[model samples]
Target: MKTVFSPLHAGHSGNVELIAGAIVPAFEKPSRAEFIRARVESEKLGPILPPEIHDLAAARKVHASDYIDFLPTVWPLWEASGRSGSAIPFTWPTRGLRGDVRPNGIDALLGFYSFDGGATFVKGTWDAIKSSYDVALTAAALVKAGEPSAFALCRPPGHHAGAAFMGGYCFINNAAVAAQWFRDHGAGRVSILDVDYHHGNGTQEIFYRRGDVQVLNLHGDPMTEYPFFLGHADERGEGDGEGFNDNYPMPFGTGWDAWNASLEDACTRLSAYAPDVVVVSLGVDTFEKDPISQFKLKTGDYPRIGRRIARLGLPTLFVMEGGYAVEEIGINAVGVLTGFEDR
Candidate 1:
């Protein structure tokens, strides 16, 4: 598998996020990508290439244009407001509040564009965000060009972002952008399988009203997990997408055997969907040692997940998502790729 990566991911480093009722350093740092890159080279899994530059045309397909316009303005607005450290939002308009109105104040605008404070920004954040988007597009292009599979090593992981709001350390939804790219280019049908520990609320929301792109996520149940809304068994799509969307929400202590059963069911549905291409939102946070997540998957189990996906016999694109256990991230994430190659 050829891997797409970028040095600009380093620019997204050193930001803080609001979690657990306190603000602290972000766990989604640049080192996570570096470790995975190193393993890809050490394992001699195909070439690692820099991404081709891309515009927001592909991203605009799934994300709102106003939300895309808000990201680049964050740092400038922060500096004008005389703020110093990472730009984090502290408030939100919930329930009966008027979210329709866009505010002029920097703090208010931040709250308006974001669901939570996790998608914090620093001066170099926009540059990093663009680079991650480029990485995803370039990798999708490879699969579209006839490669069996490719890896997009995206940072500031994107599963938590939605059409108009950013959260969960994600800015642009890379996997969603890539899935849309496939659909726009030439694909008759596309499917996204998000294996991230957290539910891919953003991806599901983007495709929930459309039947063309099938979105499936297997993650921690929303009742006890981060991004604690949606991701239930009953969220089956609304209109043309009614029976297309699927969610496998497992409890806190889920391990390999139980998780594999869910994957088996998802793959069976994926085969039935018969998409022209598959996009895997590969996140290793399900590993037992992952700090921010609560699944018990061991290093050896990742390959099994890959092998099962490989059995579906379709072109695949792996877009990196979450995995805060920096030390073991490479082994687990690459294990999936190697497992697929072995199959």
Candidate 2:
């Protein structure tokens, strides 16, 4: 598997998130991608390549144009507003609020465009976010060009970002952008299998009304997890996408046995769908040691997850998502790629 990476991710460092009712260092830090790249190198997984430059048009296919314009200017706007720290949103237009009105102020726009305060904007965040999107597109291009599989080592992981809102430490939904790229490039169907510990609410929302992409997510149940609004079992889909979305909301402390069972079922559905390509939102936060996530997956189990996906025998793209166990992230994330190749 070829790995797509970028040093620009380092620029997006020094950001923070609201965790446990306190401002803390962001778990989705630069070191997470560095460790994964180091492991890919040490394991001789494959050639590590810099991402190709892709125009914003590709991203605009999955994300709203207004949202895209807003992201790049967030830091400048915040700084112009006399803010000194990383830009974080504190208010939201919730239920009964005027969701249709656009707020002009940067502070109000931040909350208007985001579901939570997780996606903090730093001086280099826009560049890093674009680089991550480029990385994903580059890897997806490889698979579309006939490569069996490729790993996009994206940082500021993107599973939680929607078309118009950013949260869960994600800006642009990298996996969703790649999936849309595939469809636009002649793929008849694409399937996104998100193995992140948190539900891929963003991906699901993007494809909820479309039928070209099928989404499957396995994660901590929304009732007891972060982004506690979506990922329910009953959010099957709407309109043309009916019955195309699936969610396995595993409870806290879910072990490999139960998790793998869910994977099996998802794979079976993928087989039935017979998608032209598969995109795995490869998140290793399910690791027992992950600080912010709950699950019991061990490092050894990651390879098995990859092997099972390999059994599908379709071209695959592994887009990086959530995984904050900084020390073990490399082993767990690369284990999946290694297993797929070995299988």
Candidate 3:
């Protein structure tokens, strides 16, 4: 497995969060990737390096030109609002409105690009997100090169960002970007397996009407999850994409026994489809003790999760996703990789 790294992630760190009704230290830290890399080294896991940018064509295959341009500039405009140093949005746009137009001002622009309150665009936010996208594209190239696995240690995880919007601390939808690249190059079919604690609403939205790319998510029930708008068991894909999408919304207090069953079912569907490539939106937020999540998965269960996925033996790319048990995130994430290696 090749690991994707980026120093630009360090510049994206800033605290502006709401927890327990108080703005406090940001749970989504840039150091998450840093620590993950440290763990990769200490474990003596495998080779690690930052991916060389594979040209913006692959990224443009998934994101819009306007949105891509807006990505790095949102913060500068937000900062130009004349508040303090950096700015965060308090309100967001909702459904029923046509989202065809891009708002130019910061306030309206925030609604245009982001969906929720968990994310903020500091001066460096776009730079960090662009760097993250580069890292993902670089890792995707490894998949094209026939590497069985490549870990893109991306921050401000991208599973929550769709083609036109961003949320849930994600800005570019890394897995979706990679899957799109896979299709653009030569893969006949691509599947995204998002196992974040919260639903990958953005990734799902991006490929909802597409047949060639299938999106499967095992997440907290939207009824009780962060991205409360989706993740229902009935949300099969629409149109030609019908039956291509799948969601397994496990309840809170769920453990490995139940989660693994859901994973098995997903794998079965993916294997039957015989996708040319598989991408894992690997998030460890379901850890039993995660401060913000409710799933009961222990750290040791991750390797088993890896082994189960490795059984598919398909070319896989693991993109970093949410996991706030910062202390154990690396072990758990890498555990999945090592398990795949053991197989």
Candidate 4:
């Protein structure tokens, strides 16, 4: 498998995320990608390559024009208001407020486009985010060209970004973008399996009404997780998308034994869908030692997780999402690929 990486991810670092109601430290950081890359090198999983640059048109396919406009330029606009640092959303457009009207000011636009307050942008955030999308697209192109699998080690992890909103430490939804890319090329059904500790709320919202892309997620139940809005098992896809989406929201303290059971069920569901490809929103935050995540998946369990996904026998694209225990991120993430290779 080829690993597509962008060192530009280092630029989007630094910002306090509004996690658990208080802005402490951000669980998503640059070191997370670095550690994973190191393990890939040490393990000699495969060759590492820089991502090919992709046009903004690819992103435009999945993002709202205004929302896409807001993320890359909002920081510069916000700083022009005499704010001397990274731009974080302090307000959001909610019910009883006019969300349809575009806000002329950066602060207002920030509130209008962002669903949550976590996506803070720094000076170099645009370049880094642009590269992150490119990395995912490069990985997608590889899969489209017949590679059995590829790893898109994206940063500013993207499962929480939707068509018009950026939240949950995401600006552009990489998995959604790649999945859409696959659909655009030739794939009939592009199935996204989000195994991140948090359900891919943004990914779900993006494809919730469509049938071409089937979305499934196994995450900490929203009743106790970070993005506390969606991820319930009942929120299946609507209209043409009905019965195409599945969610396995597990309880806290859930370990591999229980989590693997959910995974098996998900595999069974996918077998019926018979999609042309599989995209794994690979987040290892469920590791027992993960600082921000609960559930008791020991480090050793990650390999087994990988092997199980590979058992599906579909072309796979692994896109990085969340995992706070930076130390073990590399091994645990690589363990999935290792398991796939071994199997």
Residue-by-residue lDDT tens digits, candidate 4, 1-343: 8999999999887766675678755678899999999999999999999999988887788899878877778777977898856687788767888877887888888878888778888887888889999999999999889999999999878999989998888889999999999988989999999999998999999999999999999999999886888989899999999999899999999998999999999999998999999999999999999987888998889989888888899999999998989899998999988998873
Q: Estimate TM-scores for all models.
A: 0.99, 0.99, 0.95, 0.98
Task: Write down the worst ten-residue block by lDDT for model 2.
Answer: 18-27
Candidate 1 pairs with clashing backbones: none
**Model 3 lDDT per residue over 176-286, tens place:** 988998888899999999888999998889898989999899999999878889999999999989999999999889999999999999999999889999999999999
lDDT of candidate 1 over 1-343, digit per residue (tens): 9999999989987999999989999998999999999999999999999999988998899999989999999999999999878999998999999988998888998999888989999999999999999999999999999999999999878988999999999999999999999999999999999999999999998899989999999999999998899899999898999999999999999999999999999999999999999999999899999999999999999999899989989999999999999999999999999999983
- Which pairs of residues collide in model 3? none
| Local lDDT at 102 for model 3 | 64
> Which residue ranges in model 4 land beyond 4 Å of their true spot?
none
- Candidates 1 and 3 compared by lDDT, better number: 1
Worst 10 residues of 3 by lDDT: 84-93
CA lDDT, every model vs. true structure: 0.94, 0.94, 0.84, 0.89
What digit string (tens of lDDT, one per residue) describes model 2 on residues 151-199?
A: 9999878999999999999999999999999999999999999999999
lDDT of 4 at 306: 89
TM-score of model number 2: 0.99
Q: Which ten residues in a row have the lowest lDDT in candidate 1?
A: 155-164
